[model samples]
Target: MTATSTTAPIRIGVMGAHSTGKTLLLQRIEMTLRGYGIPVNRTGQLGKRAALVPLPKMQHHTVASTEWVLAQGIADEIAAAARPGPEPIQVVLADRAAWDALAYWHAAQEWRQETPHRHDRERLLVLAATQAPKYHLLLATALDPDIPVDSRHAYDTRYRTLVDQHTHRLLAAEGIEHHRVTSDPDSQARAVDRAVKLCLKEAVV
Candidate 1:
């Protein structure tokens, strides 16, 4: 669904595994919108902030960490949308959507071969989905093993793959509408174009 209220900023949320170009995609969208003179705000680096909470992250993510990530992302989006300014922000870009944490948590559980409590799992899913409706557009990146990553950082290939799988799986399970961005440059460009068009079109509505 499109943004219905003129007062509320159109929110575009991107989610995917680490180093999957989620941040870059949002940056491109932000730049394009700003070029059109659209005031925009972007929220990101939630994983880093969550790590500061002294909470387990990455392959070690726990329910507490996941909840914190989801809640904090929601709060950040709200604050961005409500930013006080003369121009008034027309769009808010969320780097990692709320359900991202849920995908990571699922990947962590599978990596550790641990079975979490059913109630806790369901609760987190519900919490993560709370912000789903607020997103005017959602983008999910697909991991491409062929696309080499930075050699400086040591990433767990297996776990990273798991996160990618779970990310798409969760999205499909929930039947949430989203654009799937791949490693192809053309695909990335199209995703950015879609986001830009969506914001501009919704703004005039």
Candidate 2:
């Protein structure tokens, strides 16, 4: 594989609405890349980690929680990129990135008919937008209601659909290019592998 131009590791963020197989896609991509002998590191959901304060669900996301998740995500991405590796072609696969947090913030606001704290929301929005370019591949998981959402996680169909819509619009408005993956597992793996190879090839040029 051609080494990326920058010292920064290539970031691949998997994002979508709730229950869209984001986690599965992240895992499959990492596994597929490793099978090819490429070095890859993975990052999980930052918002779910024990935060300074407990974060509420998407329908109740607060400004503080949203900002924390976004900041933690950026910090985690930086650390992932800086991880020691023998080769310069390290890839970082993130299950969910800052963009997802921003999308959820909007989703939550709309769902609850409430807006986040103006100052913090604006600040985090700016930060997320700036850092988004670090992601060499932002793969959007296609909304697949065929896959059931665990009731324990979130069972709101409306909320999930709204989040998916918000995320799609944000990516487009920000001019961040992304590829949508189908629900089929095999198809997902193939699509992701193709995108990763193409991205790695482009990076070196």
Candidate 3:
């Protein structure tokens, strides 16, 4: 594998629309990589219709399942980055990134959370600047534009379009290679594996 190197294992983030198989894809990556005895880390917060609410005090808010998945993703990526290793690849699977922007953008447009406009750049800046370390591999998913949407989902898709488009470009500009996984889980997972191979190309002997 010949890919960009930062004197450490590459950092990765996996995020896509619902049912795009973000978790499934991550599972595949982990299963496949672990066969080689390489180090990997995984965490996610899924927004199922009904999921466990572990935090009693914060139960009122009852954070949605999707938020939990994204939070785990963020944390796992940060943890993986903190370690130094001789292996060429360390993979972190995050089911969603830039998820909060959905509510933030919606509030700006409908609830008047702020001005009438919300910018992807602003939300993006916040994500990149997190206390958590940054990622080098960003495997993004294209929303199945055909999927039906409720009012909330409709708004989310709109914001995701801008966010997704610019995220790929931003990472590339920073020398982080980008890959897009489609609707099919197997195909998407294969694409992710290939992307990792590409990112680790420089490490191949």
Candidate 4:
């Protein structure tokens, strides 16, 4: 069923570099919200999905792939918000968000030293920014190189670092308000607490 204007799901988005705990953080928030009897829909793994489109990812990301990722993410969030069920969804946890694609695209361009088409970059940035106002809360993770990533997935450390840097840079440039999450336990706890409180508050409203 489509949600009414007053009952639209509150969206919480998390974006950052690979293996920087974006998924784990959202999982924690989702579990906690469910414990409180709040229904949440989370959109994730767009990177893997994009790759299936045979779209270039990581350092090979192109404007087309980046645009696809951003568009798909927006569509996912829209679907989550209007999900049909016995109990309407109260929260949408966007794992990568739209801006996350822009970060990877920017990093890829920098990594390959490719000259970006200014108009294309502008269009992508504008597309990403359109969703900024929809997010009730935005969280960005800071990369801690000291923490070892899962060996199962081969990740380029340099490109990962660049993504992290561009993620923050873009957030700051857009003046988007977001909580910065780190690898520290206390930091993680605080981020989780903030999300829980926000979701709980929204539920009551």
lDDT of 2 by residue, 1-205 (tens): 1223444467778778877888878877777777766777888867568243567757677777777777878778777767776765577887787788889888888888876778877787897887666777778877877777777984577878889889888888877777777788776877677756854554432
Per-candidate local distance difference test: 0.89, 0.75, 0.50, 0.89
Q: Per-residue lDDT for 19-60 in model 4, tens only?
A: 999999999999999999898899988988988978899999
The list of candidate 2 runs beyond 4 A from truth reads: 1-8, 50-52, 85-89, 116-120, 184-187, 199-205
Q: What is the Å distance of residue 4 in model 3 from its true position?
A: 7.8
- The positional error of residue 152 in candidate 3, measured at the CA in angstroms, is 17
Q: What would the per-residue lDDT of candidate 1 be over residues 87-163, giving only the tens digit for each residue?
A: 78889999998888899999999999999899999999899877777888899999999889999868889999999
lDDT of 4: 0.89
Q: Where is the poorest 10-residue window by lDDT in model 1?
A: 1-10
lDDT score, candidate 2, position 94 = 77
lDDT tens per residue, model 3, 134-179 = 5555576666777665666435454445444544544455444457
- Stretches of candidate 4 off by over 4 Å are 1-7
**Each model's TM-score, in the order given?**
0.95, 0.84, 0.54, 0.95
Residue-pair clashes per candidate: 0, 0, 12, 1
TM-score of 3: 0.54
Query: lDDT of candidate 2?
Result: 0.75
Q: Where does model 1 exceed 4 Å of error?
A: 1-7
